[model samples]
Target: MPPEKKDLRNAGRGARARTPQFVKNFRGVKNWKEASTWLEWRQIEDIECITPDQAGVARGKMMPSKKFTSNTSLALPSAVFMTTITGSYPEDGNGFSYPEDDGDLKLVPDLSTLSVVPWESDPTAQVICDLVHQDGRSVEFTPRNLLRRVVAAYARRGLKPVVAPEIEFYLVRKNPDPDYPLTPPVGRSGRPIGGGQGYSIAGVNEFDELIDDIYHFSEAQGLEIDTLIHEEGAGQLEINLRHGDPVELADQVFLFKRTIREAALKHDTYATFMAKPIQGQPGSAMHIHQSIIDKKTGRNIFSTEDGSESEAFLHFIGGMQKHMPNALVMMAPYVNSYRRLTQAASAPVNTKWGYDNRTTAFRIPRSDPAARRVENRIPSSDANPYLALAGSLACGLIGLINEEKPDAPVGTTANEDRIDLPRGLLEAVERFEGDTTLRDTLGGGFVSTYAAIKKAEFETFMEVISPWEREFLLLNV
Candidate 1:
């Protein structure tokens, strides 16, 4: 028989003990050559060469360590980039024509992202890849590559973007059937987790074992976790990552999601990143804190020499205020994602900017000159971190170029303000497609392809009837 689970109720906490600095294997591998040497040194048996799709899901080939080293060329169908979340493809539309032959795109590994698979029984390693055409042109719509393009844009102006993401998710009871709604998992207290325990020490301790595994897995892969806290919803928790390069942080988030899910399963539960997983509960958000640095001066461009707000700072906010409405589709991608944007939820309904106010989409958090930044509260947890960061940074880049002034910052809570954002996926798609500036900035091909994919997903969702409709519309409407 299995051993009894340890009692975690009221376990000593103020914050759980920090993840010990576990030395990571293959942490210094910078190329396939180095990867091969490390594999041999550590006796790694297999390697997973993967890439993040438009939905931020890992897609690619796994092979024996020898095979991975012997075969330098790896390829996957170009269609992989165009496929929707439901595994369906959209026919040619919006200037994006699906190639008749479904040509292959080569997978070029980004060696910096290489790390060990801590959960695997056999010794294994995984590295992220970038897709490129047969002619070597980068796939514009690929999530990671898209972020690279945006980062390159910043580099061209002697600027670098630093971003920190606060990712929130929920741990739910293991449910095999999709026909039923998800419920919170029972904690070490042997009772179903309850809501309104935000920031409670005991609240986070309730799932101590699972949280411990999360930290262990993250440390094994060299992923940094700045803080962890219980969120407002039952069984919901948030992880804040250390601030760093946007691309690097996006890669961490991509891998971290997989790690979280794996750790949850180890504890006989499921971890979900859905924006609005449960009804009447607060939705999860991936609030991104962002700032720009002048590469030459090695100083934050958002602040002046005297520590006052700079023109670049206001312009960045101005850009977001102007363009973020169109980019909302990328941040909140699914039909269910819109459920989290309601006024009753702890989410912003409008694009109002304010100082340290949580009710607005863009908030200027209080920090020192070096740390001064804007927190974009619009993106949901389910968003593709790569696409979300790219969208937010792209808007700020345009704002810098236009040098436009933002409206007066809202002093009071902006919760009562009008809902300026799109109400649903279809509406958001329409706004995204109509914005030529954003389209041109974030590759036209990418914008059109993304819009098409989202439209297809929305269409698929419409085919299903929710229980709410069955309950009310079946008899009354």
Candidate 2:
């Protein structure tokens, strides 16, 4: 049975009380209750939080900090989360903003997300919050809430989605300078990795201490992580999470990233979830394996009594193909995400479906009929898991509703007959904006807000002077 909330809370409290005095002093907190508490929520491309202490209280409610407003510039709020001004603002700076005032929103904690900060120096606890208006309506811009809505839609149809994410990341030596290339950490062998070491047991053992800490902390926080394997890249590794409800899996993925990074920092290395952190190497991807089951019968909807592919399975893939172009912005949220989608990068660049073919965007892995699923290979490690799962499942739901038919499965190589997907962030955002079906399905407000945020980020990226530009253009052009 699952642990009760009261039991978990008591365990967290016990752990907090045992925190060392020196640790508390370093963290600048007197006790657990007095420690800084943050209400975290997912913004466009990253996570942002507000401390309740800074924002004044109101009738037993915690107000949002001043930086929560939509008009606030990213620079004013430490310039970390890549936040941007809402599109409602005019170019000439003479117009009304959507979130007219700051501190008008409230963060209602989801009690299930309550967890003690296992890696923090001080005894700190955090709860993921849902952004809502003062009157108690959910904010459309909230990614978690959006995912909840999608999950509810599936529940309404008596269908439940099971998702397992395989997240690939890199451990690199700490480099203070931004211009230098990142190198793999010296492992237990006292030597840095040089080239691909795919699925090597020795590779995983090299970082045994760090991986053990990650597993221990994840268990303490109730994250159900599964197998860990060395990936193809020099310093890349993949961690698999056991399949479960989409929302629950999303939450675990979100927290697990933080856990891994913290563990790496403690070990004097840096863990990066960037899709393609190294050039001329295999890129990291968050491949999502998804399957649907009938909530009533608990039967796999993708397979029939005789273990053959069901019509619903075909339609689900068809739906995914139709909506994948529009969903690219959420799946590959960053500008660097495109670098991972290049041809033969081991990342999919089209919506081709196949059986055990890694080259296809959607691959049907070898599994029992009862575990039939489709694996989406487009999403990068940098994607917000909540948004990625929500978009993917929503598209599948659309297909099931309309009984759409998928194209014939490609052979061993999908390189010949596949529709090319969007290759840039701009193209992706434009497709997302233009898709009316997605707008209605994922909400118009979310579509507009997401597009605005990505556009702002892209504009910022365009202004940067790169080494390539300087080296080539200084004398040649």
Global lDDT of each candidate: 0.90, 0.74
Going through the candidates in order, what is the number of backbone clashes in each? 0, 0
lDDT (0-100) at residue 453 of candidate 1?
95
Give the CA lDDT, 0 to 100, for residue 263 in model 1.
99
Residue range with the least summed lDDT across 10 consecutive positions in model 2: 51-60
Q: How do the residues 257-364 of candidate 1 rate in per-residue lDDT, one tens digit apiece?
A: 999999999999999999999887899999999999999999999999999999999999999999999999989999989999997457998888999988889999
| Residue-by-residue lDDT tens digits, candidate 2, 89-176 | 2121211124433445566545456555578654444445556666778766567778888888889999999999999999999999
Clashing pairs in 2: none
lDDT, candidate 2, at 364: 94
Off by over 4 Å in 1: 1-28
lDDT of 1: 0.90
